[model samples]
Target: MISQFFVLSQRGDNIVFRDYRSEVAKKKDGQEEAPPVFNVDGVNYFHVKVVGLLFVATTRVNVSPSLVLELLQRIARVIKDYLGVLSEDSLRKNFVLVYELLDEVIDFGYVQTTSTEVLKSYVLNEPIVVDAARLQPLGPAAIFMQGTKRMPETAVTKSVVANEPGGRKREEIFVDIIEKISVTFSSSGYILTSEIDGTIQMKSYLSRNPEIRLALNEDLSIGRGGGSIYDYRSLSGSGVVILDDCNFHESVRLDSFDMDRALSLVPPDDEFPKRDNLKLK
Candidate 1:
């Protein structure tokens, strides 16, 4: 996130600072630009630069790289904890968003272990919930916040006989299959929360596991009734899913009445398989 700071004077002069950094130049004008100064509210000041502000802002931001990695790890950890077991395929499924969030933090100048290793470790060991409020509701109940639609399906039942003819119970197969599936789940509620610093927080349960690897033919919606709100289709712990056609209304706003083109954030069709990965062991 791009941050900005201001240097202001009480009378009327205000200085806004954002980033900070070191200088490498010959001593010109007999001095080094007074460390790139700025004025605050009326006082004449200097010694401020985008890079310098960045340093100060980073300290103030206080979001450590390790914390970011830990968060990513915890996301995977949550899935494992809830499922009571872990699988490499499952880890791979959820790593997409975890990696994206980690990249967001890395752009802020912090570093952590590779996202893959972090997820691996998380699966091996449960992650410590940093903010209970962030994880207020425990178990599957917490994640399933919205109502879901029972997509129509054709279930077929069959049984297979064992090779040994002595006397073995046949294996039965229950196939709840469908040619087209539309998993309709929606959430319109939020939980009020706050960080340690009293930051206003809002969270909601999602009725879908957003982490499953699937090819969504549409872009993720963000706001209310936007279809991509919590992004349940892309995260872990979201419940049952179905593949369906994706269409968008022509008339809609992007962000607060801002004119922006809707971009397809979904992965390419070739990148995702045409079928579900889950199968009975």
Candidate 2:
């Protein structure tokens, strides 16, 4: 369980702080320079960085490191989803909203709900929108990109509760097929190893909560060699793609997956990964 939660700026300023259990002492100056996770006087610290700010949690009990780290990340994402932009200025401007979110997300050091949709009814304060243009550039790279003809930003940055000019919520959903590929080559310039890690991410702004149907390639095969689970064709063919393993969210239905290689489900109102850890070859 979390004993305390806080946000620190890059310069070690405590921007937002909450002591649920009051088990940990007040943070000392320069504490932000410590490692992401550390232990001092039987107290454990876990923190995650997002947009140059630190989201930190403290505890005395021995909790799962991964679980605490993921909680920090999810908390950061929840704040970003509400504020539309995550920065020190934004957090300062919407501190009331932030505190309200913290109250709903955690109950006296115990996690309640991190889902943005679930928190909507409980979070009474409206977020103060931050103008992305007025903020300082993230880094030198951001300045360099300003002159380039970049594609329009995706809906991911928009707040889930934001309304249009006529108080109408846009009915749209976004699906992203993100993949990371790794390749190793021998000194002879021959490929020694190649693999792909992919995920299907989804975010919904639709109010009706309509069911979604997502179809995969007909020639897609699972596993290696001719003994693949889905297809009988050889994997050496150019048109065929092979996936060694994949996992889906609990909300997904696989009734037609065996025959049509399709997935059906009603997406959650907030952003979530529909599929994860897809190993491809």
Candidate 3:
């Protein structure tokens, strides 16, 4: 369980804070940077950085480190979904809104719901949009833009609350397939180990919240000797892809997964990893 939650700017200014049980002491000034998870005077702290802001949670009892970190990330995403841009200025301008979100997201140190759509009904304050154009770009791209014109439109710069001229909400969803490949070489330059970690990320802005159907490659095989028809083709080297293992989100339905390699589900309001930990043979 979380005892306290707060947000701090890069300069270490406390932007937003909520103390549920008061089990942890108040943050002191000029606190040095620490690991994502650390202990202080018997209290444990879990934090994650997003858009130059630190989202932190403190607890006194032993809890899952991954769970708390994921909670922090989800909270940050929910805030960004409402504020459009997630910066120190945005959190400051939408103080009330941020508090309302925290209140709904966690009740008395217990997480209730982190979904942005679910919290929309409880949070009434409209977010004060931040000017993305005036803010400096993050990462290596900032160096290249020293003398260039304004940056182009990016996903982070768009506000979810903004509607069209006729007050119609945009209906769009984005899916990104990201993969990281790792290889280890021996002393003789021989490949000792190779693997790929992949995930399917999705973000939805559909108002009606309709069910979505995502179809995978027809020649996809789940394992080396799976019973699927694609398994035989894969063994024959007929341009078939093999996945040693894969995992899907809880919202996914697998009724048609074995037959056609398709997934059906109603996506959440915020961005999330729909499928993850895909291991290729």
Candidate with the greatest TM-score versus the true structure: 2
Candidate 2 — which residues are off by over 4 angstroms? Answer: 31-33, 131-151, 225-238, 276-281
Across 1-281, the per-residue lDDT of candidate 2 in tens digits comes to 99999998998889999999987888566543678788988999998889899899999999998999999999998998888788898899999999999999999999999999899888878777776644345586687567676433545566777766677788988777787878889999976766678889887888878889999887776665544332424335667766777788888999999898899989877778865443423
Clashes of each: 43, 0, 0
Put down candidate 1 lDDT per residue, 1-281, tens digits, no spaces.
21222232222232322232212111113322333333333332222222122111222233444543344344333333222223333233434432343443334334343333233333332222211112233457545645754322211111011111454432322223223322333364433321111111111111221222222224322222333424443653444332222223222122322233232222210111122222111
Query: RMSD, model 3, all Cα superposed?
Result: 5.5
In order, what lDDT does every prediction score? Answer: 0.28, 0.81, 0.81
Candidate 1 lands at a TM-score of 0.16
Q: Which scores higher on TM-score, 2 or 3? A: 2
How far off is residue 169 in model 2, in Å?
1.6
Residue 4, candidate 3: Cα error in Å is: 2.5
